[model samples]
Target: MDLSNIDLSKFDGLAFIWLDIETITGTGVYDTLSSPDTWFVHKNPDVCEDFICSDLKNKQIFLITSGSLGHKIIKSIHHLPQLHSVYIYCQDIARHTPLASEFKKIRSVCNKTQSLISQLAIDVAHICVNIGDQHSRLNKHKQALVWYERAFEKIKQHNGLTKNEFVNALKSKINISTLECQRFQQHRQQLGEGMNEVKYQHELLRQLLDVPTPLSSTEKDDKHIAATIKKIDEWERKNIQQIKTVAERVRQQLQKQINEINKVNKVKHDFRLINDELRQRQSEDDYVEADLQQWLERLQQLKHQLETTTISDTSQIDVQITDDIDWSSMVKLVESDVSKTWVRTREISMVESL
Candidate 1:
């Protein structure tokens, strides 16, 4: 129920006002109220600072609204001396808002409904944001912010951060991640040689943001990976060059072998020609040798025949002529001439025998 509808007489010695502070520009939850004694008020705030500077003491207020609470409302509420504890309840956004240091001392409830259940939801988120913000200031490695997310997740609808207030939430998340990123960096150094720095950085970054290993974290991460890639590229280039070199050498060797084979074949062809010429010459020499043998045999036979005929015929004629000498015939005929001829013949035959 709204404060205006409630009975004021029953709440003795206390004042009450209805402040429609929510969604109003330059208006505050505390700036609208002006009460002298212990009071309870609800009213929409003025558009200027006239309401915030007004004097009032011993007040009790219930600031109720929906939608985003502006800086004017939140800031002015911190200045109220009479308002020891304030509960600014929202029926629009949930789980995302930039809270102040006073939030640690006071209470707040932001919800999407006008029921007790919504109130309880607001209370839960308030407590979590308060506690998480405390630990975040101490740089608690995002462990403390676990409570903040868990609180919202319990009653979350239409996305965990709640779509209406997600812009602020996104901002908050970035802030949280940035802090954790810094924390992980410091952690990697302390981790020393025992911890694999690459693994450590990667794991921490995983928690902070769902992204690839970034180059901004440390020089080692980028340099080491970059250097390895460089080496691999170099190796590939060298491998191609090496293969080309080996192929060239093999080609040269094959060409040399082909030249040697051609030279040997030419030599073999020349030898075949020489063999053919020798064979032809040998045949000519054989024919010449046979002709010489025939001539030598004919000469020997002719010489033997001539000697036999001259010796045998001359001897027979000598035998036929008697030694008897007739004086008349010897005077008439020339027997002395025949004896001279016979003596010449005998001298020739003796020379032939010697």
Candidate 2:
């Protein structure tokens, strides 16, 4: 008799157990008929009497019987732990009875368990791949590499993956990191030498001063022009000195600012790279908080520059009105023909009177 020949569905919500009786031949099967109370004794006579006398507590038992006693066994089968267990035991009973139906049922359950295990393995591997891919996409190359390596290791350790799968995943991560490293290097190289803001401003101012303005005709006056030229020379000399002094001060200030900015930028770049690495290893919220603090400090320094630098109205040369005009008037004397004619007529009248 094959124990695996029983149908589990027949006992879907029912419970039953097997009773093995051994003879000198080591195998014996018999059929019996009895009531529910009597069937318990026939199935487990030694334990049934004690079991009925005792409280039974929370304990459950199943009793399977053949022929006429089967109904009684079925009645007490409800106390069994579960229907599945009862059905399993029933199949064992069928071993002595030997049937084709029972074996088919056991095969079905085995197939179901195998399917579940296969699906679980696939799901676990897929989850690992997704986690690795997400980290990789986040620009955290090192961290992504770590996740990929870990996933590959986990896949190999638990999922029984082939060596090729592990190697492929590792190579993919390495390739991503190599590309990212190259890109970062290129970006750094492109930043090159920065502009000097103070020197640029001074050069621009010098060009403005070098531009020539046309001189007016009135400016060519001897005395007025001499005084004007002296004043212009003095003003140029003074302003030139002032411009030089201011240029030096501004140059120093700009150099200082550039140095500070460079220092801060270097620190910021290092911190940013560190943060990028950390983000791969940590959570997004943590990285954002740290980055914000660095930005805030930089913003405060920019604000201080804005507050300290004073904007002034530009001074322009004002050509004095007196310098633009000559005040002295010149008059030219002319002899008129009417005055000469009148003098001649007066002389003729005086001669006629004589």
Candidate 3:
């Protein structure tokens, strides 16, 4: 029987069997009828019945089939695979069917979807790190740290593996984060130390400014003050270079510390994210890591500058107050009875004397 072109839909509620036979008889005829109609004869009806029963049992062995003939003709069919679950089928009357192509497509789609999800997770980590770095630049240390920790946590989360793998990955991330945090703290301590040194230098400058000039016994105090001011000018000129050196060192140290902390944090964060992407089977881009390394090199240069700067003390000032006044006249005026009477007769003086 040529059944390839047959529309199974036409057989609705009827049971039929198709058979092809190559016989070497004079003609393919039986019971004085054509070959096609011969299988319906009473004596050969079992031949048709047996083929129908065997094929139907084999096809219905599972829960269902979607072939149009099954839907139209089946009344109480049992053990058929659901039609929706049957994606593809290729059957041979004499051999077992294989489903290589269908499963391949399913696996490909699943993998692609997983890759997309992992990529999205990595991108989020990148944005968080960038924002954190920016905040650090603005001197918002607490906010920056918060964002950085969040980025680190997100990357760690993406290490989406089973318990054993997750535990190992989490331990690694914790170690790295701890090290990075400590390094930043050290930099901050250095910056604070440099600021303290600058403050010490400033206090020294204040002391120099406060120093009094030696006064002659007969010179007015104003003359002594003027002489001291002149000495202070000379000291300022001599010490200006040293003060500038100290100020520069402090500025460079602060900048270096800030840059170092930022660079180290960025490297730790990027490394974590890269590791996570690899584990999750996502793409890795090295641009961010390269930028962080560049920042580290720049900070190193600043540190060098800070280390090389030198501070020197300013030269001391010298001044002379002349002793040219008449001491006798001043002393007589101070001891005169008119001056003494005015001193004793004033109300303010009486209050002080009482």
Candidate 4:
């Protein structure tokens, strides 16, 4: 197949390529991704490599491949600067995880098709955010603003992103805009049109900052804390219900065992009555071969019952208690590196264990 027919440069934003040993269809992977910006290449690692080298040399590439093909081609293509990220799609995630660990560009090893699609969307958004971060660090305010806007737009489009992720993306966009506004202020005296640009940026920032409502910082914090407490309360209720269910089951089992022991005790109580009958028969001089035989048989039966009825040991039943969750960590929200957007950032009051 001629790779030259497909013009990746025609696309304004990102480009993705899927390389597998066979054509992938009906997996909804193609449908989930933007089809116009994507290409499917099968069974030709050499051609795929050449296509990236010759045609996609200038453009950044996001590649997805089967575990076997990825293992075969990763060593050859991993060094390419155009290869931004690689996703390994396979039936066995554990089998491919070690291979992914070897390459930083290998973002995730996804066994489920939906997981791959979701991760692709997230990685694309994060790439944009990271690109914006790079431009910001280099003091290129205008370029940084464009990438940040792209990131925010992508975040909004992809529903896979959590509330905190969306908010962080917005914050990054706002931060870059603030920097650009400050830069515009410094040059407003020299440039005649700088004042107009400043006004526009300020207005944009105002709209971006208008999150939900016009609440004060303290008010927002209080609202968030209340919501966190509510979530904790819900968790506590669920765990308590589970504990109650387990305790009831254990209590019922113990009762059943106790009932079996009570039956054995009743048989032992009947032994005294049999002895009284034997004593009465002997005192009354009721001596016969058949009577003696019957008495002996009755005594043997009672003795056998006592010897065969074995009670289960209660010590074997045990309750295991493990406290593995750190609930307090949820209250403290620490801001970390947002550039690694693929890594799900821990938010305040997130009970990840649950």
Per-residue alpha-carbon lDDT of model 3 for 1-354, expressed as tens digits?
011221222321112121223222332222111111222211232453344455443221111111222222232221232110111111231121123132221111112323423433343344445555555566555555655565455455553532554335434544555566677789999999999999999997776445343643235445645765665555556567765887788778666656755665565566566556555543444346766576567656655654554422223222233576443432221122222221321111110100
Model 1: per-residue Cα lDDT over 111-154, one tens digit each: 43334234433444444454455556667646445645644553
Between the candidate structures 1 and 3, which one is better when assessed by lDDT? 1
Please list the C-alpha lDDT of all candidates, in the order they appear.
0.45, 0.41, 0.39, 0.71
* Top TM-score hit: 4
lDDT score for residue 75 of model 2? 38
Clashes of 4: 1
- How many clashing residue pairs are found in candidate 2? 6
Q: What lDDT score goes with residue 130 in model 1?
A: 48
Candidate 1 residue 342 C-alpha distance from true site, Å? 99
Greater-lDDT candidate between 1 and 2: 1
- Preferred candidate (TM-score higher): 1 or 3: 1
Question: Given candidate 3, what's the lDDT at residue 96?
Answer: 15
Candidate that scores best on lDDT: 4
Alpha carbon deviation, residue 292, candidate 4 (Å): 99
lDDT of 4: 0.71
Candidate 4 regions exceeding 4 Å error are: 1-14, 26-42, 137-139, 165-170, 178-354
